[model samples]
Target: MSMDTRNLLVELFVEELPPKALKKIGDAFAQTLYATLQSQGLLEKDSMLTPFASPRRLGVHITNVADQADDKQVSQKLMPVSVGLDANGKATPALLKKLNALGADESAVANLKRESDGKAEALFFHSVVQGATLAEGLQKALEDTLVKLPIPKVMTYQLADGWDTVNFVRPAHGLIALYGNDIIPVSVLGLKAGTTTHGHRFEAGLDPVFIRHADTYAEQLVKEGAVIAGFAERRAEIVRQLQEAAANAGDNLKPIDDEALLDEVTGLVERPNVVIGQFEETFLDVPQECLILTMKANQKYFPLLDADGKLTNKFLIVSNIRPADASAVIGGNERVVRPRLADAKFFFDQDRKKKLESRVEGLAKVVYHNKLGTQGERIERVRAIAKAIAAKLGVDAKQVDSAAQLAKADLLTDMVGEFPELQGIMGRYYALHDGLPADVADAIEDHYKPRFAGDELPRNAVGTVVALADKLETLVGLFSIGQVPTGDKDPFALRRHALGVIRMLVEGKLAIGIDELIAAAEQPFGKITAEHRDALLNFIFDRLANTLREQGYSAQEIDAVLALRPQRLADVAERLAAVRAFAALPEAESLAAANKRVANILKKVEGEVAAKVDTSLLKEDAEAALNNTLSTVKPQADAAFDRGDYTASLQALAALKTPVDAFFDGVMVNADDTALRNNRLGLLATLHAAMNRVADISRLAS
Candidate 1:
């Protein structure tokens, strides 16, 4: 370490921060501070940054930060020489005015240099700019960084004086700014720099932890404050403690893996102590998902599960303080959670008393969308769409109709009203309780499958049909009303709905075409414009192109296959595979180029070009040779295409490379003789049609 440089530390101690936004705010604080300092030349190339964030504080430690930045040689451009100086080469009023504006006087004119600025010569002023002191630079960086922090929401609170107020993520109580062992004297949010900060409201060994040095902040806080100062470190410790507690709880018992819950709990405490608590076994009769959701969402508890992944009555509590005997802590947590679990059980039991069908009428009272009527009307559309899809897929239509009718019934249940995320899940349970068919029950839940990317699709054929119908209806209905997604503002998640439709058709390998499905979905909406239908189709294809790209296919491959707008999305993968295989052949490049040329030639003809070529007009040997090659190869390619061997079909075109090159090299496609030109155009048209059956191979041309 240089004698002139030392590590710097800055911390803002405040009341509890929003746990969901704590990590993001901490990272932004450190990164922006480092960037601002680096831009001012106050940091060395080797300087390092370490961020610290807990429930109560956000801090950063930076190494090799200088007390003052280095001086810089700066150049300033004045007006053009013609405007700033007379012909006698003496100072003019404009020159003196410019010099004075730059904190200079007429004396500076003698030292000013003349330089050419591209088109004209200009007067330039040069000076050595003094560096900024640590105090000045740190103050600016602190204020700038605080403003840039991604605060979820700000709270306005009065300062100690009771007159002045400040807005911050939380009420700021203290601030610490240290350069090595000396205070740098920076302030923010009505708080002055200090070395003392409180930790672990009740468990701290010291009422105010004294940080002695910049580099010792974390260690000092841990020793005297009874707090873990690093967010990641605290989270890892909590994980370790939870694992140990779960292992000791019982055989094959493990806490549920929920990263979001873990992070939220980590932000809720400065010091973590994991303890196990259990509710009555009677609560287990309710669905485990309900129990787990209540524990994690309502109480931020980690529910433990047995070997078969079934929820046990036991759960883990991440308390902020640890006492010698934890029995009371465990008992208190148990007492607090019993009422929550009892409420869940009561909702489940009450919901099942009346059949799901009874609530179907209540859906009429719920407005789905102002333009689309009520949930009851939407259910009828979904039923119509689902029945059509079920018929196309050769599945039982009666079960699909029943499932669609009851799918949204759970939305009226008390449990679903409290937890909207459990809508489809509660429907499944209620359907099973009402003695619906097992496939119908499963389909009720599975219809909402593949809710997000990489999420699983519907489990059964019945579920698959309903899911496709549901997503399609949403897409067609919203699109009809012109609620299309533009840029990143997909308020309706139309992109996700479109991708879901693509996944079902492509992944499920259904025989249904995208157009046919959209048409079926639109049928229930009465009359939809051709414009809306076309717009929706384009949207789906655009999403499919992106999906194919994410799956690792190149843009050219996807464009070539999607160019034809293949109705059956399931055929896209096969076509792209064929295009890739055909691209690898040694003759692929030449053939692709020839195909491009052929398309351009066919596009220029004024009238329709026939695929049938007149052999009598083939006066050139190259044209005749090409014509003979197509006769022999076309049948073989057609046979392969007929049986779904796209790769073999595309590979058959390899033989035409030599003949195609010869025809394009020697033949005159647009001859002065009209008869000859039309015959050659017909030949190219035939070639274009055969080559592009799988994909537009011309797109593969470099």
Candidate 2:
């Protein structure tokens, strides 16, 4: 009964879990228990679940669980009528044997019913199956749930008996299963079920908190155990303290928003106490990025920011224990963070002494990839590709060259060697210190733009050129060695590189063709076969199509536009828009069908159709009218296309619909006369070419 069910609680006490994976494991544990109970027909459809996770425990409380499942009727097929009965409709020996296996005898056969099962008649024995009691069902549910948990790493430890060992995420010490106020008999992981569990090791007021009832678990833990048992509630309290601390500091100050850091910190503490700490102000001389990275990654501290969103010397630390006097905790955290800030400052000062250009020679010793040679060789290839692209786009070749040459030079710096994430960022700072041009300095930092999906592109032309060169070099070099991505294994990030190139080309409206860029990238790696080049080009197009589909474009519209294989990606969006507009026209369906017919006819021809059509051989008025209409509409469409007005170009073809329909209705293309048939084929060829200039409109056909 939905309205008569009671709340159920289950908990597992173990050693401290992995902080990063605690939330996931807790969620999985709660969900699997709920699903297992629901599958056993012991829970109503609308039961609600509340999950609790802390450093040492995983627990869940479900509302509206049942004491026992409803009884059901089952129909068991005993045997076919032929084997169960003799010719005179009397029971046979086989019938007696089958009934004994089901706890029935010869007397039950008289009550059995005969029914037709497909091509044969079978005897069916109907019975009522008893429902499962709570104790019987919960034992199976608990054992199966422990097996299905998503344990990141398992440890095997001997139980207290010293004769048995069990494997689990951590060493399990206790388990609790309660149906209302009474304990349900259940055992798992070599531990017996109970109504009591321990709390925080140091902060709990009671050694073993007595859980009086299932519904009062959280309240009892907080009042008697001094632990906030609910995971989400604890995280919210930490966030509140962080906000309040930042507000008290001064004007324009706030804490960084890092969900991952918040989750990890939440998993590490049961009773959270936020304390403020400060470092020496001179450490601000280093880049704020370096300082912030060191504090968050090394010490797990939330660095405060000023009115301009600049990192301040003050930060917040979430301590697990709350002592009455907080001076010791604050001082200890402050002392621990000073050395990390000092190391960052030292690396910054040491890296600035050498110019960025001076480090390019050191890259010769660093390996980029086992098959792709060294970082120095990769930089040379990138520089060559950038210059070639610059020549095509009419940009200053020197700016692109300079940016490419210095892009990978930061790999040799002390700051970057310590933190590989600071590669391009340090290059920009070093270039500025060397008095390089602003455009070149910015380009050095922006070459890795659009690193992930929905990221921003390079800000200027030089940056764009070098970014494209860098991504293309990686794609072409990796693809040449047959390291192409398959299924979800893109270890080298080639798919991301392909998407980056597509974004720059389409979003920036660059005039560069994908084929031409591939050619330029391939030239630097001499003797790459044509097959690899083609495969790489197709990979780029596949990524483009998938990206477009995700942006809400229909497959029909994409196929119509991509069927033409347009070389200039800058025009793809407009072409897709033109196709969509054409598909909405009243005459689009008829015209598309005609194009499909013409394509099939042309495909069947053995030789190339002649270009010239003899006007005298046009006997039917339909052919003559179509030829006349093409003469008038072809030029207007061609002019619109040349001027980049794709919609107008597609619209110009609307005027030829009546003539096109008339020709198809009255003429037979495959005629007996050789001269007349050739002339007719040439006419259709002209129409096909004119219609496909903007996109393959036939793809819009149903």
Candidate 3:
């Protein structure tokens, strides 16, 4: 290390931060401080930073920070020579005024540099600017960094004086700013720089952990404060303890893998102590999901699961303090959680007393939307759409109708009212308990499948039909009222709904056409305008194009296939595959360019250009040769297309590359002779139709 530079440390000790936002805020605080200091030349080129975040504090240690920045040389452009100087080449009044305003004088005119400022010669002022001292620079950096933090919410609290107040994420009690062993003297959130900070509220060996040097902050806090002092270190320790505890519980047992919950728990404790607790096994009669969610969401516990992925009666608690005997801690946590589990069991038992059908009538009282009427009306629309889809797929309509009718019935149940996320799940359980058919019961739950990106789709044919119908009704109904998604603001998740529709049609390989399905969904709405229908169709295709891109298809491939607006989304994957294969052929480039030229030529004709070519008008040998080639190749390509061999169909067009080049090279498409021009247009029209059956190959042109 250089004698002139030393590592710097800054710490802000505050009350407990919001666990979910601590990681993000800590990262931003450290990074922004480093960036601001670097911009001011207060740091050496090789400087490195280590960020620290815990429940009670945020800090950073930076190496090779300088006490003062180096002097900088700067050049300032003045007014044009004509405006600032006289023809005598002496300093004019205007020039003297500019020089005086820049802390210069007429005596320095001889030292002024002259350079061309774009269009004219202009005088430039040059000076050596003094660097910033560590105290002022550090103060500015602290203030700027605090303002840029992503605080979820701010609390206004009174300072010690009881008259002044400040807003911060949490009430700050102390601040530490150290450059080597000396205090750099920076302050924030109404707190002045100091070397003492409190650690664990009750377990600290020292009332105030006294930091001696910038390099010894973490070690001192751990030794005297009874705190881990680093967010990552503390989290890793928690993970290790959780794993060890789960292993000791039983073989092949593991805590639920939820990174979000782990982070929240880590933020809740400065020193973590993992302990195991259990509930009565009889409470397991309720669904595992309900029990697991109650433990994790309500109490912030990690529920253990066995090798078969079934929930066990055991759960793990991450306490803030470690004691010699932990039986009391375990007993206290288990006692606190018993009533929560009892409430869940009670809701489950009460919900099953009346069949799901009984709850269907209560939905009429729940408003779906001001314009769309109630949940009861929406269910009718879903049923109609589902039945229509079933009819097209040659499936049993009765099952689909029953499933769609009861899908939203769980919303009124006690369990679902307590946890909205369990809506579809509870419906399936109640339906089965009511002795409904297996497929129908499954459909009631699966209708909400594929809830997010990469989520699984409906599990069976019945589920698939209802899911499509449900998503489609949501899309058309919202679109009819013009509640479309704009930019990143998708309050209704219309984009997700659209993608779900695409997934079932494409992934499920359903025979239903997208346009036909949209029409069927719209039928229940009664008299939707043609403009709305077209708008909804365009929206669906737009979503499909985006999805195809995410799946690694190139923009050209997606555009070419989607441009045709293929009604059957199931055929889109095959068409894209064919386009990709066709693009690889040596002749693909020439044919694509030729196809583009042909489209442009046909677009210019005043009237409709018939596809019927007149062979007698084919005067050029190139045109006649092209005509003969098409007759031999068209039937083969058409046969492949008819049988759904898109790759074969596209590959068959490769033979026309040579003849197409010749025709475009030698033929006069727009001849002065009207008869000849129309005949050539007719030929190009026929060629365009033949080439575009799979995709518009012209889009592949660079």
Candidate 4:
């Protein structure tokens, strides 16, 4: 098991590649090579494979490839086609069909057999096939390897490119494929193999590099004043230079996570160098988010920080080349960033003075959709529903009203107008400027905090109220507008909004009735078609079902409780959680047997017979006793519900288990007499009424 240190050279040279695609394409190229080599069984030992790329080229060098495969037996099996044919001692047409299917030339097959099933078998014969050389085998295997390679984006130049499409990300200018010291000719896309590789476009004495092996690939490119390698190396070099420049000037710099910036910086340089630039104090007046976005989003410059956590006037700038005079680059960078910050500062001041309330009227002018009415109309519906949600939560009604009114007002603000990402943040700033209560202002901002899944939930009661109102209006409006979500498309993100409403109620411990509020919000959809109403209800509930699963509730658990009530989403969540908890108790397994027995009896007396029992007709002692106890417990259970003591209500219902089991064992529910049937049904009806206070007990899983 000797390690063969054979050098493998591979390169794809083309037009300058965008930095964004280089790292990804380089990774994909390396993976394809490893996967292909494994499939061909060429590299049996552990190997070192490294990928390198620049604006115009991507290459790889593999170190520990197997010198050669183990020599073993090559079994070849092919019988004369005439051997398995008809009884006649002849070469049949069936034999011809078999040969054609195997891609053997018809003339190549000898029409004779030696010994098969005596005389008839004797007509057929077989021949041995020779195996080819390992190098030839390797060449065939590697030739088809290019088809499996995936390039991120490609562009066509002259003749063969990566794929035969309209155009690729960049043209395949030249390629270098070498196996050890020898050239390996394998045609990929349309390009053939050679040892010639190009160097830095600007240098290298006007001649392309002629590298015999991959080990020298990187070294040759470096000598030509080009760094054709990894993103990490380039990134580290840039940071090192930037920090050095910053430290000399008594300013500390730190690297931030900006993958897009890192890539653009990679493409901006063959060799990266850095400098620090500063601006005036007036720019700090803008919001932290605005200033960060201005620097990171616009200019791709790293920000400088002071000893305090506050931002400084300086920024770190990375340049492709180290200019002889560094001040020229620094001066150029400050000029670019200053205008960006000035625009942000101007947008901040203009937005601050304009009150949120005055802009509320302009929302109606903005169309949420041509069919779904104006933003103003949507706000009116949200306002009406917010009051309902607030009342359910026992929140301050005045604050709820104010939040709904101003929530969408920031849509017209200059800050929100310029930065769509700052919608709710602007609302909070504007709310404070208007001298509104702190609770309402915080709600206006926090309502949209969790704009996506796994995002933070509302922080305050007011935010929760507005969030519910906003989701309900959307569910009702979309259903009313006949634009319900389907198998794929949910253009409105209605599902996220609905899940947000459900999650807030159950997880946030808010007690609210979903159906009642949704129906109230549906008031504005009077013009809705009947089709829309039915479809919307199903879509809304389906989204709720999905949300329930996401929150870790099982299908059986949800279905067990959902059948009882449709109005209270939060209450239903509580009931399911309690049921699951109760089910976990050791005694509950025994309790389930009694429940199953009760369920079986109830299932028998479903439709024909009434459920309420007449005390006079309770002929059996157990039936009579159970009926009396239910009468006593009914008033207490009703009282527990009024006080929101659900746990006590559940305990009260469990009291019926002994008597229910006794009644089933003693009396016959289906008797011959019509009078007896009616009497038993009446008794079961009374028992069901008591259980209904807990849940639709019939719907609870056995």
Candidate 5:
């Protein structure tokens, strides 16, 4: 009635799984399990389920699943009831056998209620269905679902001949499938699955032990000195161990916030082993970012700090094996990582010897995009775009040009070559080594801002200019080649580029239209032309609306701005903010209602003649007042538009409220007098022009 309250444990033992595969596999397993349980009619909130993966195995734990499925009542249709029978009511020979079988089969149908035809020759019956146990259903589902589970890249070893052909990311060594204390015997990919699983590779290899129950699995690993499952638990243990080690060393471990490292270290070990390792303090002279990158990337170590809040010469290493002597383990890890630091320090020293500017000549030989040009050519274009954008944004023109010139110089650096992740990072270091200005170094570093959603933006104007240049170049290049992001595949990250452009404008408060900037950036591209003009504009404009709406504007609001074809991004944002704010204004509500009436009146004169408002034929006091109101608001709206204060313009347009409402209610917009009707159409044209100054009010709903 509530929950199964039974724990389900499934562990698929393998030789080892890659760290990247762990997340995907674990997610799929949890999703499949939850989907099965939910379909089996269990309430998810009352149930708990989770999955964990490590280098050796994938394990799942589910608690309090509804033990039994909710009772099911089904109704079955019997062969249309009249298709096989005649009006005479006697069972035909063909139908007699079908009826006799149904009558004797009690399991197929618990009860059958027959309805007789007027001729009494035929009988139709509805049968009752018997409920089945959820446990039995789950077992059957597991049987059918295994082959469908996603293991995108498979590695096969040590099974039957066809086992090598068996599709899995890796070889399956063992399986532990349990519900409460019972084993669900499921054989997948030639592995005889059971409820019991062993802890750690050594114990599983040495003793061939089996776990008999779900509740015993976690503690069994504990007895084997294993912290086998949850990452949260593993991370907590690492922190506790690191804190104690830090206390002993008279330093505190300042966290570097490396989630990727934490996850990798989590899977690399079955047990929590925190080892404090050290290198020579001279290595600390290397840039902290470079040092951290080296330690985390190559050595898989976390650095520590002195209580003074600076990186210490020490680092903390999380090991899979806890040695019999703690010092011996710490010494071994320290020995391994010191050599990595040595190599990094050597690279740093060797790189600094040659000025970064001297390295500029080497990028000419490296290709950026085959169709586009060499990385050298790209650097030139970027410098141009940056200079232009910088000039527009009132940035120091010299700094912008210098930063753009040096931005791609790091691509040829040995350090960047060794660590592909350090492209922009290496540039900053190189710029400083070359004696370039801080603004130049900053632009090199900050140009990659808003790399992902919610990432930090550039703090300096020089960086902002370079960022915009970089984004526009990529967007224009990709669109020129007709390879825009189609349905989620943004190989070039064009969506990200567009969003970066938006962030640049919104965050920098830069008052330039995205389309104008994109067009200006594309002017240097020889491939873009007038024939595909609308296509290019649509591509950029549509993305802006999509990105803006994602930041949470209503669909109508998004359409309303694009309708205005704004030239400044600030104008678009201002208009949108104004429209949303205006939607709640009392005059806005009345104006929308009046416009709705105006639209309805226009619908009747559709096939007759175009109506234009005539100044001389204005007989209705309502019409005169409405025309006066438009005249007064027109100049105010124009002034507001000029200053980029759309809110004021929108408020000014609200002046037409009373007259517009009264004109629609008291006068027929279309009359037998076509001149008067035409005059009214002219009035609407004026209103449309007025509304267009702020937004397309026609797009606004009543």
Candidate 6:
């Protein structure tokens, strides 16, 4: 190895890339190429890598890349010593044939080495292998990277002669590979390496920017071609322009925060120039969500918001060209967005004409799933489950049922039909238009709350009930039809629905029993649920366990609490807290180990142990001490448990540590006397029952 090094640059000019996947492709290309070069011993340990991605190109610049790797000793195993040599240790015919295959001959046998390979002696050929040249390594690296790219879809196009074709994300038009001031002469995607590439198709100062050196690639592209070649640099410029534009609009006003939109817009242009555009004020009457979604999704525009976070007629656009007379760009963008905003307004007005209540019948015609009947039938099941949950919550059943019945009505509305993401939002608006109560209307929308992780929960009690019912119906119905999620394939997003259910029950402090809800949700499905009810319940609990684990709760703590299958979902958090507190206690380890011993002893019994300990049968001092301690501590522990103070309940059992240890150390539970053994079993059973009110503390045993 030598200290000599040179900077390297590689570029692939192509047709416009998919904006959503540009960042990923750029990162993969740079990383994979760097890895391949490093594996080939061409890159130094301290080399720096910079990746560039734009609408029409992907490139990378690396510092401290070597011209060639160091030469290395090579070893070639020929054959076992017995096969390669005769009795007198002369070369055998097999050895001569193997030598010939390796470009050697019998004359080379004198230099061959004999070495032990495991237990067998083997004949080995040693030689020196030359390091790969830059041209050779870069060509292999480029072809490998192109072949292994995560292309969403590849386009096949012919070369200049039209006889051969290559498949790439987009047809590549140019390839550049430079080491210092010289070309590496690599080729890929049917394009030969070069020092020239086009940039900013419409606005580049130079028709073909020529790179004079490897380190000047970015500077050359920006200075000569009028393009911002770095993805991060381009994105930062867009953000700065957006902030400047929004600040100029008014005080406290800002552009909507959408990272995905910003990234996509960044990938769509080589040069960015933010321009403010405005639509007519009349279109503002439609819901701001409808307007904003259309602007961002359809036109890639950033909708401006006022101080109070309300959508205004003004928006911002990122254009590739910056013209001196900017009126045309602004006007063209405004005109392009007007029809989109007008379409949103039309859907809003036409949808309000028919109340959400009127659209309820339309749901009957829409099939939810081929196996689960129509949306109308699903709504009925959700309503039934909602009413049951409402009754348990002591809420108004009529309001909950009404909310559930019309929750999916917006699916039939023109606005929601056009934008499926607006289903519940539009439902809320239409429900309010029909003069429904605010709570009912809000619940119609809130039923879809917490649609993603870390999202907000339903805003009110009624909303909570409906959301539960909606999610429960999906879980039970899907499980009944055997459409349960397997591996990573959750077509219906059952995992998300399950998490939603868990979040509502635990976070809302609702005392609804999971088993009761599952049973109620399954009643409408008839025998389909009868066979799969257990599996569905387990699925829900599994989601609960995973959620707890993600929240940083230890696996042992979750197992201890969940093993009991607490009927009320709201009590799980309290029990987990108790287990954590109990584990931190000084006596927790001994008591946990003793409890485990008790469990194993009791499990081996032929029949259930009746928790009826006779005082007279307890003959040993340790047994008597344990019985007396239980008599004293059981009341305190039970009292704390009955009052919902789980921490106190678990802490109360810490007093029995000494007696429990003594009992296990001094008494034989399997006694020669049958009466004494039964009585001992009874005592251990009582201890088990008392200790596990909060959780199975035995799970915490070492």
**All candidates' lDDT scores?**
0.91, 0.90, 0.92, 0.70, 0.73, 0.91
Candidate 4, residues 92-201, lDDT tens digits: the string is 57656665675554564454434545434333324443333335444554454444446565554556443454345676677777777777666654667788877655
Residue-wise lDDT of candidate 6 within 4-118, one digit each (tens)?
6899999999999999999889988898999999999898889999999999999999999988899989999989999999999899999999989888888899999989999
Q: Model 1, residue 220: what's the lDDT? A: 84
Candidate 2 vs candidate 4: which has greater lDDT? 2
Q: Which residue pairs come into collision in candidate 1?
A: none
Top candidate by lDDT: 3
- Indicate the residue-level lDDT of 442 in model 4: 91
**lDDT tens digits, residues 1-702, model 5?**
444457777777776677655666766766686677677764345567677666777777777765566666654345434554457644455555665676643233234445555544334455444434655656655554555467767665546754346657777778877777887666666676675555665533324556768877766666652546755566677777767877766645575667778777776777877877788888888877778888888878888765666787888888777667778877887788788778778888888888777877888898878889887888788888887787777889999988888887877777787887888888898788788888889889888887898899987989899989988888777677777677878788878887788777877678677666876687667648654555656776787888887889998888877876776665677789988887878887778666666666655655643434567888899888888888888889989878878888887887788888788788786678977878877787677667776777767774
Rank ordering of all candidates by TM-score, starting from the highest: 1, 3, 6, 2, 5, 4
Model 4 residue 463 distance off true place after TM-score fit, in angstroms: 3.6
Q: Estimate each model's TM-score.
A: 0.97, 0.94, 0.96, 0.74, 0.86, 0.96
Candidate 2 local distance difference test against the native: 0.90
Q: Taking the candidates one at a time, how many backbone clashes does each contain?
A: 0, 0, 0, 17, 19, 0
TM-score of decoy 4: 0.74
In candidate 6, position 632 carries an lDDT of 92
Worst 10 residues of 3 by lDDT: 1-10
Whichever of 3 and 4 has more TM-score, that candidate is 3
Model 3 residue 414 lDDT score: 91
Ranked by TM-score, the better of candidates 4 and 5 is 5
Best by TM-score: 1
In model 5, which regions exceed 4 Å deviation? 1-6, 41-45, 50-52, 64-73, 76-82, 89-138, 148-152, 158-165, 202-206, 243-253, 305-310, 530-553, 571-573, 596-614, 666-679
Candidate 3 lDDT over 576-659, as tens digits, reads 999999999999999999999888888887878889899989999999999999998889999999999999999999999999
Candidate 6 error regions (>4 Å):
74-128, 527-531
Show the colliding residue pairs in model 2: none
